[model samples]
Target: MGTRGQSSAMGREARDPRLDAVIQTLQEIGNLMGRQAQERAANIAQATEAATTAAVNGNQANQGQAQLKPPKFDGKGDPEAAPRWVEELEKAFEVLGCTEAEKVTLAVYLLQDNANDWWKATRGRVFPEGTAQTWAVFSENFYGKFFSESAKERKLAEFMRLHQGQMTVDQYEAEFARLSKFAPRMIDHPEDKA
Candidate 1:
């Protein structure tokens, strides 16, 4: 009976040792898997953060690059006129691709037409900062370059002729009436106000 009891105890010990080994192995595997999962999560988080930063930076750059000048029309007689005309004009001539100078120039001309030379009286109101010259202002307003040089010269000569009090009122009126349809409308050329 003593021998049989000893044999049973031995058998139990042998089985238990195998079970302990299996549990230990499984625990080790679980720990390793947990570490791997943590590493994977960290990597994914880092990638996502980088992508978000890049997207935000790209959007910021685009906003800066897309800067365009605003269109201008003279305030004419409006007291609370906008100050964006010259600002927009500068941007139009900027090397940026998003600016349009011609429309802004025409808008400025229209404003001058409305003001009927009153704009010059309020030069501070119309041209806040820059003391822009007439031809330069017109040239920069939209054309971004010089006007048709010959046509400009001819027009200027005619303007001088008309303004020097050489032409009769009727002749000047008829000639200007013809010019009104096609000539670049001026802001403060005494010819118009006369």
Candidate 2:
């Protein structure tokens, strides 16, 4: 009876030791797998962040390149239809790399048929003939012929009479600032400006 009990006890001890060793080996493998998964996740996150940053940097570089090389103008304008012809023309001149001396001739070339008529009629009347002038002179001459003093005065009066109707305070302030450029002499005091 003692021999039989001892053999049963020994068998139970052997099974317990083997089971414990198997459990410990499995736990170690699980821990190692968890660490590897964490490392993989971190590496994937880092790669995603780097790719996003690279895309943004590439966009910025493209924008910088675009600014360096200005777009070409097709020289299309109408004084009555597009009232801001002078502004458009000036932008085009800057893009086309036109010098101050070449501006007048380029302006003449780009003028629509009707605008050319006005230019011819008002060239000497507004500005002297054959003047070696900047784009500013040409702009003043062209705009002066079309935009009369009466119109400027009307615009200035409208700007002065502006109200913050149906607009937020920020919107009203922006509108006021925009209109103020039209009538620089009207608002002398900063208090009145506000």
Candidate 3:
């Protein structure tokens, strides 16, 4: 009777094949789930890093644009003032890294009094509905209204007649710089400009 009881205890302690299979399967599932969770965490971290980079870049661009302070134009000064204002505004645009479309928009915003009125009248002619707006188009129109052909001819003549005689070196250089804009073709090369 003691031997029978021992045998019964041994049978009770024996492992089942089906139960062992089930345990192995559960461990495999847990390992697979762990790998999947790690991958998901890595993907989320990458997306978060990308978003942070884009936000920082956007903030930097906004800060640069904010620092720009273009001068205004009222179409009431010397005809040369028109070209000078355009030059100043272009420098501001370069510093701000503005797009061509942005250049036209910002340039238009700086127009005041007669200049604004001129734009209002000329806008339709230059930028008909459905036409793409560009800095070149805006510049052509603005120059047409403010800087006349006659004024440009006068500037070109002044540049052609420029001489260093009698004037100080600095004065001659200043006058040359002032008149050079009218004849860009003549000074297209560095040596020619010099």
Candidate 4:
């Protein structure tokens, strides 16, 4: 009876080693899967942080550029409108931080009534479209047609005669800057410009 019992116990010990190996393998697999899941979660978190930082930086840069309100156009370009429109439009561009190309296109759209028709039919060329060419052509056309040589001469004379008057230093400087465009030739030296 003792020999039979001993043999049965040895058989049971042999089966237990195989069951222990299987349990150990399952635990190792579970630990590997847990580590992979943790790594994936960390990656997702890092990506989300980077995206948020980029969006915030973009908003800040845009704010630094231009947060100005949109402008309404009264139309009626060139000649009669040249004086006021030049000042007003340039100011609007500064406020809005528009590109030179945008200034040209916006100038066209701003024209009202007869001006738009005249420009589209006769003055505005279509062959050289896009930013650089359009800006150059439009500037040449606008200054030549709208602002006549005689008118520019008169503005130059006015610029020569201009003084500070009763205005503040800031106001005087602004007026000088505005008038300077008419007599660009006078500004030959850096000291003269200053």
lDDT (tens digit, per residue) of candidate 4 on 1-194 = 99999999999877878788999999999999899777755764554455456556777645433323223334444343565565666765665445666677667777766657757775435424442645556656766666788888888888889999899999999988888877787876546643
Off by over 4 Å in 4: 1-105, 123-133, 190-194
Clashing pairs in 3: none
The top-ranked prediction according to TM-score is 3
lDDT of 1 by residue, 156-185 (tens): 556545551687888878877644433454
TM-score of each: 0.24, 0.46, 0.61, 0.44
Report the C-alpha lDDT of model 3 over 7-122, residue by residue, as the tens digit.
99898679687898899999999999899777755764554455456556767645544334557899997999999899888877665456677689989999999999999988
In candidate 1, position 119 carries an lDDT of 45
**Model 1: residues >4 Å from true position, as ranges?**
1-15, 59-194
**Model 1 lDDT at residue 91:** 53
Ranking by TM-score: 3, 2, 4, 1
The CA lDDT of each predicted structure is 0.50, 0.64, 0.82, 0.66
Model 4: what TM-score?
0.44
Top-scoring candidate (lDDT): 3
Better of 1 and 3 by TM-score: 3
Candidate 1 scores a C-alpha RMSD against the true structure in Å of 25.1
Instruction: List clash counts for every candidate, in order.
Output: 1, 0, 0, 1
TM-score of 3: 0.61
